[model samples]
Structures are given as C-alpha cells and as structure tokens.
Target: MFDWPLLRGPVPSVVVILGAVSCIYLLAARGRRGWWSRTVPIVVMIGVIVSVIADKVIDHVLYSASVPVEVLAWIGFGAGAIALGVARAWRATWWQRGVVVVTVLVVVAMAANSVNRYYGEFPTFRAALGLPAAGEVAFKSVSAVVEQPQLPVSGRALDQDWTPTVRPPAKGVVTQVYIPGKVSRFTVTRRAYIYLPPAYSDPRRPLLPVLVLLHGIPGSPSDWLTAGGLAATMDRFAAAHRGLAPVVVMPDATGSLLGDPMCMDSRLGNSASYLAVDVPMWIRRHLQVDDDSRRWAIAGLSYGGTCAWQLALRRPATYPTFIDLSGEVEPSLATRAQTIRVAFNGNAAAYTRATPLHMLAAAPHPSVAGIIGLGRADTTFGPQQRLVYAACRHAGIDVRLLVLPGAHTWQVWSVGLRRSLPWLAYRLGITAP
Candidate 1:
C-alpha cells in the first residue's frame, strides 16, 4: 500500500530499462537446449523470492527510508514471465522468442500510466537509461548575463503603454545568480536562481512582486526549477498575463546541498539572517521589484516551508504572507534535547525561544495571511499543519488550509504551487486581491 504512490513516478523508467534488459536476455536464452530449459524456471523463481527477502532486509535494517516494494515486484513479475518464455522456447524445436518480448511489453505498458504523476515529466527520456540529461542548465546567473536594474528610492513605476525591452516573451528566462551576501556575510556559497518574467523588461511593467522560493532540507535551489516545474508553471502564468509575474528569487538557504540549516542563525550558518536580510537586500539592490512588504511573500516546501513560517513570524514587517506547503510545526531534530544540543549547543532555553511555535505565541498578531497546503495522504505533516493553521486563526491571522491529493512527493508539491501561485500573485498585487 505504501509503495503504490512510489510507482506513479518511477514505473516508466523501470519499464524502459526492464524492457531493454529483457530483449538482451531473450537473445541469450534462445540458444539454450534441453536440461537447461527446466533449470531456468527454477532459477527465476528462486531469484524472485530471494530478491524480495533481500529488499525487505535492506528496507528494515540497512536503509533509513521506507523503501517501496511495488516497483521491484513489477520487475520480478516481468523477469519471471520472460524466464518462463525462455524455458518454453528451449523445450520446443521451433524456438520462437516473441513470447519473451510480449510478456515484457505487457508488464511495462501497464506501468507507464504512472509517469509524470510524481517527478513531473523530467526533461529527458535518456535519464531512464541512467544517463545524465543533456541541456541541463545548472543555474541562471542574471547579473553576469544582463546588467542589474537599479531602482530609485521610490521604486520602478509602471510605464503608460510601455512595451517590453525584451519582447515576444515565452517562458521566463531562468538565470543563475550570485546574490551578494552583504548583510549576513554567509558564504556567497551556492549559486541562487532568479526568474525574470516576460514583463520584467516591459516598458509598461508595474512594480513586480517578489517571492522567495525555498526547497527542502536535503535539496537545492534547482529542485524547484527542475523537479517542481517552476519554469513551466511561471511561463504559463507570464504568457497569460503579458509577462507580468513575481521576481522569483530562489535563494540558497541551506548553504550545503544536503544540510537542513533549520532556517536558523546557529553554528551551522546564519541561514535565517541570509533569507530574511541578505537575500531580500540583494534582490532590492539588484532587481526591479515592488519594495513594499505587502508585495513580498516567502514560500517553501518541507524544510523550506518550515523556514517560511519562521521567517514570516520573525520578520513580520518584511513578509506578512507566507505559504507553508507541508511544513513542520516548528524547527525540529529527532528529539527536543537533540535539537537543543545540536543547534544551540545544549541551550534548551535558546532552542525553545527560537522555535517558530514559541515565537508565534509571543509575537503580536498583525493582519497577515497564510496558506497551509498539505497532501491528504501525507500523515506525518498534515496533523501538525492543522495545528499551525488553527494557531494562525486564533491569533486573528487569516489562514487557509488545503489538503490536496497526493502523498509527500512532487505530485503534491506541483499542486501546492499551482494553488499557491495565484494566491501569491493576488496578495503581492500582481493580481487583484
């Protein structure tokens, strides 16, 4: 049951790879004769049983993740059919290898339905063969390719009947950037991504809003661009609205590619400061956007979603609207003691003081709006999200809790973004409130 969702995204790749391997095995098995025919069936049956046991052991004792067995089960089922076909071909004088091909194709065709349901149509099919996808744009560095836009103290205003400096906008241009860490002074570290909608260069461009999109703990800024389909989604919105979209700054909050950062200014790094101060400061200095807090939103998923809530409450004046897509209730480790030990160097009081739930309790309730979007099947985070939503309502803050269809996977996140982006646009004044 747990493995059913995993099959949705990975089955197509499995089919392609499994089908290829089956073709090769079909040729090899065709040359076999008498005694070997019977042994092949016995061997395949044994192999299937052994593999299942091994997978269970690895899932329970070795790996940390709850490894799904559905995909592997499909592979075994296909392999078993091929093995039976091989046995039959060798037994008869007229060795027809078509049986193996038919069985493999049938199994694969059934699995193909689940593709793009989770990973969101990866850029290339070659990736199914375990090859690096070509045309992979690492990060779009806008500052290096184009000159930085400098806004006056007032800000960039709308142009009457203004046309875009760069016209015929398709999807937004994603450029990798090195946003200066002038305030936090954290490493200029990993590259961040900036998305310029078609309307950015438009002469009639209104003061565009800004959304700081954050990824999960064990993830990169590129996760949003690649797996989350940020480019495609934004492009659709931009194409509809004549290139008018938020100046999307996908800043790297987690300094390391795989570290949690917890959105805290701790021994790990000044990640909270980086997001709240450095990234925003750099965006204002370098990009043309509405400088108003009302026009700014900080949004994230998983770890980044937790960061969004933390940043919103801590710097309520800077970002009043935060979209938490499947975020935790507070900054967490395996245990409270462990969190205190690691983050604040054994200072339990500091850990409690810095937690988002604690901070939200102490802070004054300002007129703010929040979106708590969680996947309906995601049991771990959904309950906590409800608590946070309730807290927001009790505090006189406006909040909407949406339980979308999907588990904790890209399928859910894609929906989360699709739902949140319009609201984000509406709040930031890109669309009418």
Candidate 2:
C-alpha cells in the first residue's frame, strides 16, 4: 500500500487543502440535515486522521519489504487514491463549484511559484507556509539545479529522439543487499550495492580488494551507479590494467540528519555500527573478497569523503587505504573547541574523541594508507584536505594529498576516482594488464 505520509512536503499540503475543501463543500451541499451535517464533518475529519495513521503504518511495513518493489507499490497506491478522491468530488454544489474554481486558481499560482523555484528566480511560497529562511534558500538552490533543463543531445542520437546512450558496466554485476539496522524501525533500512569487478569470475585469480563507496547528503547508493559512472570507469581501467579491477561497495550513509555520519557512532542512531560493522560483515559473508586489511580501501565524495577518513581512523584494522575526494575533516580541538562543546552537549573532550583528527593523534596504523584529493577551485574543501594532510604528515602516516583542477561537484570526484583507482589497485596487489 502507498504510504501517503512519505510523500514530500508539497504533496501533503496539496492533499490536505484539497481533501478539506472537498469535505466542506460536501457538507454545505447536504444542508446539515439531521445529525448528517455534523456527523459528516466529524467522519471526514476522522477519515483524514485514520489516513495519516494508516500511512505511517504502511510506510513501516513497506520499508521492510524489498526496496524496489516497495517503492513501486507505494507510488501505485498513492496515484490510485488521489485519482479516486478527485473523481468522487468532480460533481458538486455551488459552494463546491466555487471551491473548484478557487482550487484551480491556487494550483495555477503554485505552478507559477514552481517555475520560479526551478529558475532560482524568486522566493518560494514556503516562507508563507512558515519554513525557515535558510531552509527555503537551500531548497530553492538545490531545486533550481535539479529542475534545470539539459540540452537535447545524446551520444548516438543527434537527429533522432533525444535519448542519452548510457553505457552498461562491461563485466560488473550490480546487486542490492539490505542490512537491517537498529534505525530501520524508524527510518529506511540501510541499502548497499556491491559492484563486482570484471575478473570476479576468474577462479585462479586472488580475490580483489574492496573499496567501500559512500554517497553525499540527500543521496542514495544509486547515485554512484547513475551519476558517478564508477562502473564504466572501473571497467575501462580494468581492461587497460590486465584483468584486475577493485570491487566497489556503495552503501547509504545518511542514517542521521547530517546525511553523511562522518562514519562516527552517532548518539541519534547506530549509523556507525550499520556502516562499520554490518556492511563489512555483509560483504565478507556474501561475496568472495580479500580478508586482509591491506586489500581493503575506502573512498567517498564530499560527505562520503569525510566518512572515509572517519572510518579509516576509527577502525584502521578494517580499511588499509582511505581516499578523501574533496572532503573536509572535522575541526581539530584547538580550532573547534567552542563549536564542539556547543554541538556535542558542552563536551569538548567527547567531541575530540569522536573526531578523526583526535584519533590520528596516536601512531598511524601501519596497514592503513591515505590519499587526499581536492580541486583548486573548491575553496571550501581544499583547506580541509590540507588540514588532514598536515595532521597525517605530523603523525608520520603514509598519506598523499593531490590538488586536482575542478570544483566541488561530481566532475571532480569522477576524475579523482579514475586517478586514485590505479594507486589503490597497486597497493592492494592487483596487477593491471
């Protein structure tokens, strides 16, 4: 069943306004006769209440099911319900007629506002709805880029339909594995996609090292498969460098509000356990992977980059190579004393304990290797890379910082991954042909 509660912010507003207006018009037409008028309003209100409750229950149930099927089923249910409701209220009284007209006008106005949101051209009506100003601005900025139109050009279709030719993985297999986390009771279960290298089928070869890939805030494992194009790049690299390719595991890391957990054990949930414990366990149990720390690496973009450092620092025994692609490290004690104290319940020491910088104060793990990449134009993350580089240098850890050309977007990360893969493969004892 569709979980209406899972619908985005605008969807609920649309449903509530339309549903309430429909109920009001129905009552007005029925003339409030006998207890019918009073009873109908109460019943309609009750129905609304019941629908919300049912939505939550359904959401919980669906989340536990297979992820792909659950998404499709929920969408289908939501569409059917909306259609039924609209059809039932199509014919109505004078007040109902007036409501229909007003609703149409309101929808028109909202559509205009959506256009503005798409262009980043105007302030959204969300402020009128009482959303925070900063949230509104962020929402507008993100939405504008997402909603922008792409030119109708494809690799193979210049004169035909404007369909982009998406190249499939040459010899990789993409499989979704669900690992139940403690937070799954309240939120979506953690999802991980394992991408096997081209040589995975070869029986005589040693198992390839695994690179745990993480996505940024508001993104899922599918982001790498769809946007990052890691599989295609890895395929090409493998073909060039013998038959060896590193297995990549993309896991959802946004178990907390900060999106990327920085791979720390969060007080809000067991996100760190989900990533560090559950994910590795799942990989080892299900796939043919190298068991040694020297064969395991971790890399991520943006928030994932932050997580890469945290995971490596916290559990150096598990991951040997850490790749930070334009990622910022949590501020050091001297730099973030006040901010840490405020953010972590006035516990500066606790903050330091949880931070990657603090963990690196001890001698670097001999098994662990670190690579930091940043774009020159990415002023925000460049300095962060430098900080991590400096700390690793001071600790006498084997770390390399590469300043590439680009900004904070996927373009930089994609290029960084291509460059970093060869080094990672070499360290992991995988020979490129």
Candidate 3:
C-alpha cells in the first residue's frame, strides 16, 4: 500500500490534508450561529479521525496480503456519516445540513485516496485504460521443434540447438511452464510463461540468446505478455530478421501472485534464490539456451524492476546485463525504517549493505551493463532513477538512461521495452555488432 506522499508526493499530500482540515474548521465555526450546527463539525471530526486510522491499518494489511477489503472500511465511514446525518437532518438548519454533506464527502474522498494501493493486476490510471486486458494476451505451450546451428556459437558447444518444427507466423509462440524449484526450494508454487521467437521454429537457425523477465508486485508473469506487449514486440523484431529473436523467459519473482518478497531471501519467501538460482537452473534444464552471462539478461518493471538490479548486481556471474523500467532506487517497504524492520530484521546496517545503490557505489568498477528507463513526469521514481543512473555511470559501469512519456504508467514501460530491444539484442549477442 502507498501513502499519500508516495502517490502524489509530500507537498500535495500536505496541501490536501490542510485543505480538508481548513474546510472542517470553517464548517465547524459557521455552526456557532446554529445550535445543531455546532454538532456537525464534531461528528465530522470524529468521522475523519476514524477514516485516517482506518486508512493506515488497511494500507499496512493490503501491502502484505494484497486484498480489496479496504473498500469495506471506506464504506463503513460513509455509512457512519449518513447515520449521524439522518439523526440531525430534521432539526438542522439549511446551512448546517449542507455543511454536513460536504464535510462527509471530503472526509470520504481523503480516506479513499489514503488507502489507494490496489490497482488490480494492471498498470496505473492511464496505462490501465489504454492497454489491453489481461485475457486478451495469448500464449501457447511448446511443441515439436527442429534443432539447428548457426555461425558464432555463444559458448563451448555441448547441448543440441533448438528451433520450431514449422515456421512461426507473425506473432511468436509463448509456452506455459511449471518449473519446480527442486534445487532452490523457494516455493515453486506459481507457474511461469516463456516466449520463443519465430527463429526457434526454424530447423536451420542458430542457438539464440535468452532474456529472463519478471513482472511487478500484485501481478503475475502474464503482465509482460498482456500489458507490456513484449511478445508482439519481439515477434515483430523476429519477422524482420527472418525469424531470429532472443528467447524470452518470464519467471515468477514473487512466490504468490499478490505477495511481495522484495525479491530477497527473507521471511516473505526465498524470492532471491527463486529468481537468481531456481529460475535460471530451470530454464537451462527445460530449454536450449545460451547459459553465458553475456547472453542471459534479467529485467522487470516497478517491484520486479528493482529486483532486476538486485539479481544483476548480487549475482553478476550469472546475469551481467539488465533492464530496469520504473524501478525503485532500492528495495522499498515504503520508508527506510519500515524497510529495515521488515527486510533486515530491524538492522539498518544490514540493509545498507544490501542496498543496490550502496553496492554500486562500493564496487571497484564492475563491468555491468544496464538500461534504465522511466517517464519524465513520474516525479516519484523519475528523479531516483536518474540518481542511480549517474551513480552507475560514475562507478564505471556501462549504463544508459531513457526519459520517456507517460507518467509512471505502462505507456513508459511498454515503450521502454520496444525502444530498448535493439540495444538488448546487441548486448545479449542476438544481433551482430
């Protein structure tokens, strides 16, 4: 769950809160002329307090559980105000009645915004409306494919190459897989999906590179397929290259669909092990892939995007290239203290040690490759990403930053992926330099 400051920043939250308070004060002062009017602001003040407390509790619970029960608390506030309103409406003066209604509405609106955390499985306001629904995105299971070979093998050849038995149409095939975490043992409960390019179907194509992708919190791996438009984007790239594109594998970073593990091996779940260890092991065991660090990349958006940096920075031997789309500067459970309490057993020093920014700052010029992209209007995360990008650049890491349109919405993330493909292809060794 997000605080008012997280959604709209500190200044906006302060202004709105003050505005509500001022309106209530004036509403109460006007009641000095009327007997029943005196009780109007009193009831309203009580209702607003109830709403505020309810807001905090609901946000904390929903952040852990990801349920839609916060609406119930909002409904309770509304009903309480209505009941008090009806009890006084008969004897209250006209102005008093009007003030009560307006006060209740303001309280209710503020309460709703305060507990505004869940946006279903899609992106925020603008992107949710513009992007395709989750069900509209499609994927099929892997079937017969012809193994092939090509120029410039990625590493020492051992396993046979892979390709689809038949040529893929415009849109490539996405296969659903339930990769068990036999090694990492980090709760292999959630099933994941993979995208094979058109070239995978060719019997004469070279062994292709791989991209291990992930999605945001309160979301499944399907978000990339449905809203991010990655499959279609890669398919288009493949069509132009005679069916040659990187194999895209989207794994479940969060153990439960709505749960956030901060992509770390914490009490929430062994999520870091799940992604950095189990996911790659499963991919190599199940599919024909380029296991080299240069050929394998990991990336995500928002929560998953931050996790991408964690995996790349912590486990650089496996994944050296990464893409972070609108990710937080570091792992966030809202505030620094709360994040420390939850993720690091209240040990602030331990958290600082694991922080991506700190790790990047302390590194002795690691040869890490990254692409950071976010919306220009996303005040909350835009500035943070810029700071991280600068840190990475100064630390001698090869990193690029992109400022796109769409404020913290899927518009920026989707376009970021589309624009970064050529760069990703080159880094992953899918395209010729």
Candidate 4:
C-alpha cells in the first residue's frame, strides 16, 4: 500500500473512470420534485463561484502563486459533484443515500488524485502519509559514524587528488538533525536533513565540497528529500563518479511548513541571516567538509530558488554558484507594496536595497555564476525567469538559462535538479567542467 503510485499508472485512471461513471449514474437516477433539473444547475453555478474565489484567495492572500486552471477546474467539478450527491440523497431511500455517500467519496478521491498528479507532490502512499524515506536515521547516530580525525583536502577539486576504489560503500547515508539558529537568533525549531556521500566514509576522509539545498514555501526540508528526490538523485550521481559527490545539506529556510520568510531579515523572520550565516557556519563546524567558500553552492525550487538567487548575489563570496528552479522575478509576498509594508515597515528604500534586481543592476558581479531553470509551460514564471536572466546577463554575471519540460510542479523541479547536477558538480569542484 505504501508503494502505491499516486501520480502515474492504472490507479489514478481507474479512479477517474469510476468517478465519471458515478457522476453519470447520480444525475440519471430518477428522483421526485425535478431535483436533478433544478439542483444541478445551481450546484454548477455555486461551484464556479467557489472555484473563482479559491483561485483568488490562493493567488492574492495565501501563497501569492497562481494555481493552474486545470487544478481549478477539478476543484469546481469536485464541489459540484459532492453538492449533487447530497442534494439527490435528501429524498432517496437509505441504500440510495448510502450509494450517494460512496459516490461522493469517489468523486472527492478523483479530484484529489487529479490535483496530486498535477503537482506530483505525493508520488506514493508513503509520501502522502508523511513518512520519512528509507535509510533515514537520527542525527546522533551520524556523529559516531563520522567521528574521524580532521583530514582536510586542499582548495582544489576533489577529482584532482582522489581516485575511485571498490573500497567505499555503494550508497550514502541521510540523517535528520536539529540545526539551531545560533547566529541569526531566529527562534524557529525545525530539523534539517543531511546527505553524506559514500566517499565521506573513506578512512583518509577527504573534505568534500558542500551544496546547500533550499525548499519552496509551503514546504519543509523534507520536500527535497521526498518530492525533489534529493538523496536518490545524489546517490546516482555519486555512483557514476565513483562515490564522489558533494555533501548535500537541506536546512529549513522557512520556519514552518506554511511560513514564507521571503529569505530576508525582516520583521517576519531573520531567514536570510539564518540561511547565509547560521547554515554555512553549522555545516563547517559539525560536518567534515571543505571550508573554502568557493567550494560551496546553493540551489532551490520556487521560493527556495528565489532565496538562492538573493543569497548568491548578496553574498557572492560565500556562494559563488547558484541554481534557481522556477523562481519568481524577485522575493515577494503577494505584491511589492505588501511585501514592503509587511517586511520593511513600508520603507521603500530599504525594500529597494533588498531587491535582487536593484542589487544586480547596482554593480557588476563578475565572480557570481548561476543557472536559471524554468518550466516550458510555466506561463507565470517563465516570463519572470526570462526577466531575471536578462538582468543577470546585463549585470555581467555569468549565468545560464534552461527551459525544461513541464509546468510549475515537482516534475519540473525534480528534472531541473537532476539536469543541473553535472554542472553543479563541476562548479563545486567535484568533477571537471
């Protein structure tokens, strides 16, 4: 049951077919007082209104991101179907009501499964239930496993001095650790997940490079672990390179699952400071990795992508390389005015100082290099990404823009991560460029 695929295969299709048949049966079944004739139209109208309101609420007040029209259609269809079921059951027999209830449930499942397939958020039953992936362990256990003498490597690439051997383990290990906001003093308690490559266990322990991953808003560090397929992706790369992969660190940028820090030191949260200062500091102190700032890179999807772009431009010395997957034009909350009012206390000047476009245009960042990834069908963010790419190019920043297939969903993000791994590896000194 845990392995039941939610996104693809015959399950979703069969559920959809059942839901369609149920809808037809519910509408066609004879009833008193011309119920189907009067109620169906009213329910459809109400569903349309509700869907419009929901789309507006999500875009304007909640996430500030647009929901695809297809998903909105499903929302309306579900609403109408459920209302029809209830209305019909009002004058039906006991068994008929029972059948209505089952029909309603199937309709709900169909809508839910359709939405899930659209976003690819929960690809399996296990993920939908919020369980950790296989081979994940507590942080305390990792400490004992990595208690080795300090054996630091040079500032050069790992491929420069290291050779692959059959001695190293075939797979890496993932651990969940609580990374306190020590320097930023940002009081948000969230555990981080770390992926140590197989080469990390070498007796002659070479200090590997680090890659800090950030997840989108409405997400936790585990999004990268599950939806983004971080560990599996990194493990595959490691296998190809003879167990040589950067130490991937996934720390919480947003304090909570629904929190949007905007990756700034604002009244809402000291998210920028926590990510740029405390996260890197913690990585160096706790993990046996290279201390060279140039050896580090930052990458993320959506909100995390925007944050990565912000940090890389703001602190080029710390993160000279970055990957932005389906990021917005800038880090914002609904609108520029609202973001300024909420985050900067309505200080437009202060907001300007924090905006990435302003910073990029202010000076030439010749040292900063990054990749801007966009989904081919992402109508909303595709334009935003092109605008950002132009800004980066004009500012003399070494940047590459990639347009992959899919919309603003996990499909695009996961593919973006996998596609960018080779370039990331080269940039972080894991392999040759």
Query: For residues 328-358, could you state the per-residue lDDT of candidate 2 as single tens digits?
Result: 7773212355445444657767777888877
The global C-alpha lDDT for each of the candidates, from Candidate 1 onward, is 0.69, 0.59, 0.69, 0.86
Clashing pairs in 4: none
Q: Rank the candidates by TM-score, best first.
A: 4, 1, 3, 2
Compared with the true structure, model 3 gives a TM-score of 0.69
Give per-residue CA lDDT, model 1, range 184-216, as digits (tens).
766656778777777765554455778999988
Q: Which structure among the candidates has the greatest lDDT? A: 4
Over 1-433, each residue of candidate 4 has an lDDT whose tens digit, in order, gives 7768888898898998999988887787664565657777888997898799989988887798888999999999888888888887886899989999999889988998899999998888878898877788777666544455334455556777787444777789999888899889886668898998888877656678899999997888888877777788888998888788999899988998878879989998898999889999988878888888888999999999999999999989899999999999888888889999999999999999888998998877888899999999999898899999999998888899999999999999999989998888888888865
lDDT of 4 at 225: 79
Candidate 1 lDDT for residue 12: 53
How well is each residue in 23-48 modelled by candidate 3, as lDDT tens digits? 45434433334535556656566666
Candidate 1 residue spans exceeding 4 A from truth: 1-168
Give candidate 1's error at residue 375 in angstroms.
0.6
TM-score of each: 0.72, 0.58, 0.69, 0.95
Shift of residue 200 alpha carbon in model 2, Å: 1.2
Any idea what lDDT model 2 has?
0.59
